[model samples]
Target: MAPARPVVPADLLAAVLRRDAAGPLVTHYDDRTGERVELSAATLANWVAKTANLLQDEFDVGPGSRVAVALPVHWQTAAVLLGVWSCGAAVVDTPAEDDGGLDDVDVVLAEQDRVAAVEELGVEELLGLSLHPLGAGMTGYAGAARDFALEVRVHGDHFVPYGPVDPAGPGLLLAGLELSLGGLVDVAGELADRLGVRAGDRVLVDARAAEEAGPVAWLLAPLAAGASLVVCRHPASDQLKRRAEAEGVTATLGLGLDGIRELGRPAPS
Candidate 1:
């Protein structure tokens, strides 16, 4: 029999439930405090669904809408990116360090820490990801920007796609060396199956890949497969190991030779 075709988010998410329905999908590790923060698949899905709904209802994010996510490597980052794609909109991969030429984006989903820098880009609305949920002051607040927490509370976990998306259309947009979309999707499919990544896998990715392979491999690949991803907020030798061990990382999708070496480096004696 021929291999089965991969289902898109709209068709797959509802049927998939293998991941930690109760455990954590994303775990944030703080080297300074040695703290670990977790977000389960169920919870992550809820957030993604709610956030997707808000983006569609409030920002009018749909086909042709480009949203920029300015977040470090973490669970929130993954959720925001997935949420954007779920709405059939393209995700603009903005450098966390710079926000230049973001005028074309209709919505800006940014991190609380980078709000000030993104503000300099002249975006009308900015969504800040907070530690807790807020009930108000999100939708069209202060002209355009809204708090992510507030948006989720008001927006329930129901993601309604504007229409059927063309697989050939732009799924993710990024700036860097150009690569063919067919090649990119093939790589993602290969890696997803090779790593045994499933809806239950809690993957920890090295930022090296996030910059090169684009967010498709780093974010959507596993997400579409029903796996949860945890991106370290910072890159540190010790921190990487702790995150891998603590989060029970099954595999890492590396981008280059240098990243592979760094990921495999031994601990200091």
Candidate 2:
């Protein structure tokens, strides 16, 4: 057999937005912050567009440029990820800590703690993850700096697609640590079918799965199949099981045997 084609994770999401520009898409769940953010196709498109602009205009991220995102699993993370892809650049994701050294990423967008971590890594551009407004030294730290939310707000609601991107393009860079291995999952037609994903299926996935597996089985696979993917911040076994049954999860992916066992045990009927 010929070599398998690479999967560009962002394209899978883009396709869903294009296919049903009016349907439900990503539903964000955050346990730490008790926040739940939902997005329709149109909203996802707008967020991606604004983020792309910020990456382009502020960070100068374009073809071959690399941006390091050191944020945790949340809806903001998703928006930033899609923005990086929209800019036609590669994402270099590191965990919220400094494992060692970052691999030559041009820009670093991270949470407050991660900003300090990336600072030590010597990345050129740094953007802080501020859910609210930020103060002082915003753009004068010998590097371009901006708050994530503010940056998004400054841009227009429309997005202009960037340079040539193939299905084989590099889409994500993921964190690697204890029980955490990260890589990109290409979005293709076949994988979606293999996972029993279908249009309108609300996918409930663990945060760790999304981090480790990139966007394939968790994010892209569902979207590629015309379904909506709901990402939970914390993947408590009982919580996931309850969410699956309550949220009407048609098919779930990225769970290990332990999660499967927890989910499969007969529920009180």
TM-score of each: 0.73, 0.75
- After superposition of all CA atoms, the RMSD between model 2 and the true structure is 6.4
lDDT of 1 at 169: 48
In order, the Cα lDDT scores of the candidates are 0.62, 0.63
> lDDT tens digits, residues 1-269, model 1?
64345444433334333434676556665454454567766777787888888888888888767788776666666668668767877777877657786888888877666676777778887787643322223332243456787667778776777776545445566774322233345555665665556655666666555555566667656755667666654456655765566666665656212222222234234
Candidate 2 pairs with clashing backbones = 7-186, 199-226
What is the model-wide C-alpha lDDT for candidate 2? 0.63
Worst 10 residues of 1 by lDDT: 255-264
Off by over 4 Å in 1: 1-4, 9-20, 131-144, 176-187, 193-202, 207-213, 224-230, 235-246, 253-269
